[model samples]
Target: MTTTLAKDPAQAAARHAAPGQKRVTRRPNWVAGTASWIWLAIVIVPIYWIVITSFKAQSDYYAENPLAPPSNPTLANYQLVIESDFVRYFMNSVIVTVGAVVPAVAVSFMAAYAIVRSGRGRFLRYTNSMFLMGLAIPHQATIIPIYLIIIKLGLYDTPMALILPSIAFSIPLSVLVLSNFIRDVPKELFESMRLDGASELGTLWNLALPLTRPAVVTVTIYNALTIWNGFLLPLILTQSPEQRTLPLALWTFQGQYSVNVPAVLASVVLTTLPILVIYVVGRRQLLAGLTAGFGK
Candidate 1:
């Protein structure tokens, strides 16, 4: 098809803009740019302090400007943190995080596929509402029941104690997000799979899983972060020193190294690296999920 532009430049620009007949140039929004930089500074300043302080000597920390980089950076604080059984806590955290996230994501994906594919019924509505209700409930309110249940199961002071609750809490939001992504899959693709003699499980595995992978990765990252940083559950549910996750260990580290500010900061930095790595690796899928979620 042939397209024509208006005689006047501004009018032509406006007219063709909608039809892709012309390109429009616009000035940058300076206010937004300025605000973005300002916000970036606000965030970066604290992180910069934490990173620099971690390398400073305890004596130097009190003497030096908080924002200034250490002239003689040292690894003593890091070495000390490692010496304080940080490795055991780190392994325990890995156990709980991986233990929880795998089952949680798997169950969530299956439940989501079912919810989206199932036709509307009283049961389905009730089930979806039940999952949505989990989101509204505060985590603190369930502590008593969770504690009692753990005690009864003889799983107290075990990594399983943390893993079980983490999985339960992860499911509701995971299902909600995954279900929406699954719903976006074209129905005709499902029909085609059906005609090719695929079962519902086969169709879900081959069709919906690949298409909703970004959302899956997004949830996996989110749940990992949540479980990794979780303090309360670890604090209340487990008591043995071996059961300590990073957050709880950090708490104990702060108490022991409270007078040694540089040591504490070093411990904090070590505790944060795994979470930082996971977020960085999955950031693309995370951003894609966020965009799709908020996009109109």
Candidate 2:
């Protein structure tokens, strides 16, 4: 009986309970639930409004209540945006993003590998310090100097003007993130590869690259988004209508006194769709890369 009572405490408690005793369960926190729903609504409402407004005619959009669904939804806004130079602007954005992000990731990964693998060399340490310092400098502060340098190099108003500055700015953050991720890789694996007569490049390519892929993907997506949506660089650097990116192209829809609100919003929606797709595809990797090394 003692053994039975010891093995089944619930049964024993039930058997010995006084009359009218009842189990009490913890209640769900309704306040927290309500707050979560409120926050979700705050976020979701704007996105819903943008999507719905994109379908409304400009006349209807201004005439009807802002939050009300369009009585006669139309695709004219999308048609107008597509009929413009949207495709050319889109291609320019793609070229600049790819041109910047690829080289930035490669160079940053290599630099990060060296910083992690090289043991306290003065130059490497100084280089790492310079990278960290870059994070403190605001882009606006350097725009004038960058503009002058671009003119000196005769790259002003060219896609290379945008690409070079983007790569330069992206490097510091990329190195920081990649170096941290690389530091988490087992030193034993690197040692084994070295013992097997693999060169440093081989080990970096074969070992570090594979292990740090998530961080690479994260930084690539991040840099892509930054360069894609970058307005200041394109605005200050490029001059011609042909050189304009999507962000700049939206200005074409605005007249002196009035704005084509639906067409402008339509441009925004189209521009954002690619970014949304990229995030959805790589979100898991991004979360993993960010969370890695936190426990240590």
Candidate 3:
């Protein structure tokens, strides 16, 4: 390669540019750069307001400029939120999110693997079509039937009520995404594993699991975020205060006539913190998995 390049004077000169000279040039994407800044502002402005407002006193929140930094930042609102069964609400949210996400992701992954690995038959084909159809069904449309079903099952007003429905709702999309990832896996790999006397379950664990980790993490994070922030299910299915998830528990700051603005914002911050942390931690894999799915 070196001798070939050296034989061509032009190529050799291009290969070793003059000192303090540029070989390649790039034009700044002014349009994309400007749009990115605008989008960033749109996202960050509300978050900045929420964080700052959460520290303000209720009276000052009304009297002072809402956008300005608080004259006197206080932990009183946070303290008030904590005193108002915030811990219980936080725990309830955690339980519901974990309970719903783990089972949903696990089931979806296995279903996806089967859909790809299992031979195509009328039954499997019908099942895949059914899952695809589910993507179009909105939660609102099914809430009434779900409510009735929950009542009949005697699971109403309990965490289980929320868990069961969330799992069901989460599966279709999860299966769709996971199946795409699993389908992208080489068939030769599966055959080699089978040749080595690995059972289907063992091949799924040792081969599929490791190769498709990014997709698994992607679905897990997505489902967890959805379940964590879910309001309608908890609102309709569980009537009791103890069963209330974070979104529902924010009602604590609301009065019949007036609302505690600062306390509400504080609770919002507390509720959002966990999911935010999880996203930050798993963001890389999530992006990779999503890219892989899209590329496929």
Candidate 4:
């Protein structure tokens, strides 16, 4: 005969517990729940006001309370905005965003890859330092110099003026993000690719690019948003109405004596929609990319 050890009392209790039963957690704090609701209302109220105000007529907007729902919602503001140079400004924005973001992300990815994989070459180290230094330089500080350069280069008063500066400013942040993500990629994968007779570019194309796609998408979206809403660069670099981006187009709603507040809001809503859509679509990838190296 053999002796058996006694089961732990807790174990016995757990074993006797009914199948499929789950332990109940304490209820969330009422204070936290109330705070969350309050915060949500704070955020949503303004957005609701904007969307509702965008639909109100000029007469109704002045007649009714600022926060009240529109008694007679009208598309006249949107229609007026569309009939103006809104489409041209919209296209200019799209062109600038695409032109700037694509090249910025591509160049940043390659530069970051070099900085990460080249291990500590003097040039790479210096380049990385330069990018870090760029982060410290504010756009305001460079505007005068950039304006002069644009004039010298004959890029002034053109979409290229906006695109080039946007791309340049965007690169520093993009490289910072991408290089961090690239650094997190396992060295073993690179080594394996090397052993299989892959060139550096081959490994980057076959392995690194695919793995770093989330980061790429994140950077792209980030840069796109920045360039899309960018006001100063467009304001200073370009003068022609045809070259104006959406932010500049809002100027049309202002007059010497009166401002078209509802029309301006409508234009704002339209300008914001594309960027909002981009963020909503890429939010998951953005969160994942940003958090890629946190575990270690």
Which residue runs does candidate 4 get wrong by more than 4 Å?
1-27, 255-258
Q: Whole-model lDDT, candidate 2?
A: 0.91
Q: Write the per-residue lDDT of candidate 1 for residues 1-296, one digit (tens) a residue.
A: 99976598877668667664656578999999999999999999999999999999999999999999998999999999999999999999999999999999999999888888887867877888999999999999999999999999999999889999999999999999999999888899999999999999998889999899899999999999999999999999988888899999999999988999999999999999998999899999888887885755
Q: Estimate each model's TM-score.
A: 0.90, 0.89, 0.88, 0.89
Pitting candidate 1 against candidate 2, the one with the higher lDDT is: 1
Any idea what lDDT model 4 has? Answer: 0.89
92-190 in candidate 4: lDDT tens per residue?
999999999999999999999999999969999999999999999999999999999999999999988998999999999999989988888999999
Candidate 2 ranges with C-alpha deviation above 4 Å: 1-26, 255-258, 294-296
Alpha-carbon local distance difference test for all models: 0.93, 0.91, 0.89, 0.89
**Residue pairs of candidate 3 with colliding backbone atoms:** none
RMSD of 2: 4.6
lDDT tens per residue, model 2, 155-257: 9999999999999999999999999889989899999999999999999999999999999999999999999889999999999989998787766555521
Q: Identify the candidate with maximal lDDT.
A: 1
State the TM-score for model 2. Answer: 0.89
lDDT of 3: 0.89
Tens-digit per-residue lDDT, 45-77, candidate 3:
999999999999999999999899999999998
Q: Which TM-score value belongs to model 1?
A: 0.90
